[model samples]
Target: MKALAWLALAGLSCMAAADGQTQFAQKANATDVERYEYATNLDIARVIHTENIPDDICEVVPIHIFYEDSHGERHTLEYSVMGGHF
Candidate 1:
């Protein structure tokens, strides 16, 4: 019983840490997409998620990247990319 309790506690702690790491700031809005700029200082520690670019189109499209910085703060970056179907 003691072992099981310890396992449960460990599991909960892991879940909480995972949850906290994924909490990205709500900076991107419909009108305010966080576009990337040249020479922008990005302190990315790990990329959490990336929006898939459509392969069938051949034009500029917006892509979103969700990442965590070195300070453990989550951020979203939106940038334009030329589509791959060109």
Candidate 2:
């Protein structure tokens, strides 16, 4: 019984860790829009993920980018671009 309890506790801990990592990716709709400029100071180290553009639209649309900075902090940036340009 004690061994089973330990196993269950270990499983819960793993799940908690996974949840924490996922929280880093801000929701697309919840993130603020970031206008791009020629002199914008960005510290992006790597692109973690980019929201997919809808196929039914052909105009400029908001795109959400999830990235990790040089300091290992995650961030989400929302910008507008021509749809289906990927």
lDDT of 1 by residue, 1-86 (tens): 44323322433343322443444423345554456765556666766655556799999887766666799876677766678797
Q: Best TM-score goes to which candidate?
A: 1
User: Would you list the C-alpha lDDT of every candidate in the order shown?
Assistant: 0.58, 0.56
Model 1 misses residue 45 by how many Å? 0.3
lDDT of 2 by residue, 30-71 (tens): 634465444556666756655565677789887655667799
Q: Model 2 off-target regions past 4 Å?
A: 1-23, 26-35
- Measured against the true structure, the TM-scores of the candidates, in listed sequence, are 0.61, 0.57
Q: Any idea what lDDT model 2 has?
A: 0.56
